[model samples]
Target chain A: MTTLHVIAHSPFGDQRLASCLRLLGADDGLLLCGDATYALKAGSEPLQMLQAANLGPRLFALAEDLQARALDGTQVIAVDYPAFVELSLHYDKVNSWL
Target chain B: MKFAIAVFSPAHAPSSRRALRFAEAVLASGHDIARLFFYQDGVHSASANIVAPQDELDVAAQWRTFITEHSLDAVVCIAAALRRGVLDDTEANRYQRPAVNLPAPWELSGLGQLHEAAQLADRLVCFGGD
Candidate 1:
């Protein structure tokens, strides 16, 4: 199944995000929201780790969350709530990392 | 539809209660729950030592009774449970603990169980901490 893992916590602070990363299957994807938007900042270690994982087009970040945190310049695609809903429909399962 | 629920918060948290309600609603609507995985602080729901006040609801007991009545596959992550002092009989004995708090219906398992649930279920919704 194509799974979409929604991470709503900060990368450095919460251990669940790391657990989510470790559980990612080959066809699985990730969606960053809430405090997780901080992880999308360019040059951040978490972003590097995501890149190293080779998630490619599967990685996404919520535009509203990033804007709320005043974050910009992310390699990951920035999607709105509607897009988020659409992504959830596209995937068979969604695992929120909180 | 087969649904899998994951709870990331403890029994004291609102998210845990919300997850339970959601699960009940799903089952009432004729859906099947493939598994319920409790990770991180959510493992507290499986512990039997919780004592709520007379007025306030006992979330742990609520989960235990509901899971028992439904014969649900409620799994508490072993790593997360051990780290948070939520132990089953096997874990309590292995760690030399005085008592086992995790209830019988709720099993202590690895993260692989969560992955398996995700793959098997049609949808996997998570209620997590803020």
Candidate 2:
């Protein structure tokens, strides 16, 4: 019954990230990719809030996206395509927040 | 496992192309595709009138052939498709449009169909939006 939520927009621009956050449940996991990787910058309050609110679910960001954005020391786990595939397989459903 | 795919970008968009590749890979990996739902600008993929230059890749055509070959259900959101001017013969007649562009095998449906597909499939994946 776990849902894998894939978010691809920046928190600063699109409301999708917020909507994703609001919809996420205790059993759901979050993966930040594309422009969303920018949210991992150090000292982002929203990012911190996301971390605090969803401790029961796993949080991840795309490593390739992070590298593209030059974002390092992200609080969320960095994952590659293989990890992405693994997550998709582990979860019962995937809800892409696009 | 059964999967339902949602495409949220136009056929010409890079993300749309990527979605095709992903779906191909999933099928090659032996997964079953329950449905391919087209939402937002992705409804363009169902338009039969789409024409590409001989040199460029005809994305819509590719989707048509693939869907036909697999006997997959490709559902385009009727509301979204109408707003975007992608219409089937029935819709065209209702609206008195000059032409109908939506082709066979790609059916116009409501969002409820997408919801049903999500519930029926083991996984629901999406491509290209936001």
Candidate 3:
């Protein structure tokens, strides 16, 4: 499954991010950071469509996604600037999955 | 998903770092990044004379290293960079300048590159001011 992390901090909000999310198939995961409420507002409708379609691992807001990952003891797929740094630091560890 | 990021803020500012970090994050997420375009004041981030205080991080160096490490296509709008005195080697010679400050791993190009990036990328993320 592909994971997309969107860092939305521009005045244009998350319109671009939302459009990308809408284009993804059901098995994709979306991780949003910074101005997430803005992403939620921009993506609400498309997210509902994906949910209704029963697409797996759809949009994940910060808190809910983190908490769920913690409860399941699983690493959540995330896209964001800081998250990229973390991944780069540990590329070798995750190379097998990639 | 494939993505592109457009940065429009001056270097050393919070917004600029935020934008760079965001681009780094997008790449880390295991998705493809088509390009990183610097427009308006954001082109200044490619300037080589950007010396930060000892206490502050060297943003220009950071961006250079990041782009080189990732082999990311980093383009600065030629018109904007020239207007702001950020010159490439060719432009510096054209203008008969003594030194060229615009660093490597960042190319100067027209807005057509930006348009091409938008067309190629599934998501074109813009950072900094409107």
Candidate 4:
């Protein structure tokens, strides 16, 4: 079954992102929120890692969080909380890395 | 849709508030909540000892009231709770502890309950972690 992996930690000091990438299925999705949104920061190693993951359209972030952090989210789909709730139903299941 | 929500952050943390809001939205949209599982530091949300400062929002109280108003099944991981000192009266008596921080509407259960809820739920949405 396809799963939506939600992460909220920093990619700089945590291993959840790397671990998630390893187990993410072909149709699975990854949603970055809170500090996890930092993964979309430009020219960062985590950005490179995410780029290599080739998540494409499946990559998403909470728009408000990105905005709060002043991080550009042009590289990924940015959704609000309402859409976040909608996405929980869009996938077969949601696995929050927390 | 049935959602099994798991909370892993402490009561004072931001994510726990987010989890509460998400659960509120889930119910507002006419969805069913399979279970509310409090693990790790999230078990503190069920504690009676949480005293929020005057300026801060009382999220723990909000969570308790929400569960009671909706008659929701709120489960706290027994292992996590015991270690974290979030004990019901039974656990308090069992452990010969004098304090009881857990109360009604919040049941202390094993981790297996989370798995069972997950099995029965359409989606398992978790909040907070290290």
Q: How does the DockQ of candidate 1 come out? A: 0.20
What is the Å distance of residue B19 in model 4 from its true position? 1.7
Angstrom error of the Cα, residue A8, model 2: value is 1.8
Candidate 2 ranges with C-alpha deviation above 4 Å: A18-27, A41-57, A61-86, B12-15, B49-61
Query: Residues A21-63, candidate 2, lDDT per residue (tens digit)?
Result: 7778888889887777767777786677676666443888767
Q: After superposition, how far is residue A64 of candidate 1 from its true place, in Å?
A: 24
Stretches off by above 4 angstroms in model 3 are: A1-98
Q: Give a tens-digit lDDT track for model 1, residues A1-98.
A: 78999877788786766678889998998988767777766788887777788777888987766777888735778886446656765798787765
**Per-candidate interface DockQ score:** 0.20, 0.34, 0.11, 0.60
**TM-score for chain B of each model, two decimals:** 0.97, 0.95, 0.95, 0.97
Number of the top-ranking candidate, with DockQ as the measure: 4
Q: Write the per-residue lDDT of candidate 2 for residues B1-130, one digit (tens) a residue.
A: 7778899988777557656766776687677888999999999977898888888899898899999999999999999999999999999999999998997989999999999999988888898753
Q: List the residue pairs that clash in candidate 1.
A: none
Tell me the tens digit of each residue's lDDT in model 1 across B1-130: 7888899888877567757876787777677889999998999878899898889888889999889999999999999999999998888899999988986899999999999998998788897754
Among all windows of 10 consecutive residues in model 1 chain B, the one with the lowest summed lDDT is B13-22
Residue A83 in candidate 4, Cα distance off native in Å: 1.4
Best by lDDT: 4
- Rank all candidate structures by their lDDT, best first, as comma-separated numbers: 4, 1, 2, 3
Interface C-alpha RMSD after superposing true interface residues, each candidate, one decimal: 5.1, 2.6, 10.5, 1.7
Q: Scoring only the second chain, what is candidate 4's TM-score?
A: 0.97
| CAPRI grade of model 1 | incorrect
The lDDT, on a scale of 0 to 1, for candidate 2 is 0.81
> What is the CAPRI rating of model 2's predicted complex?
acceptable
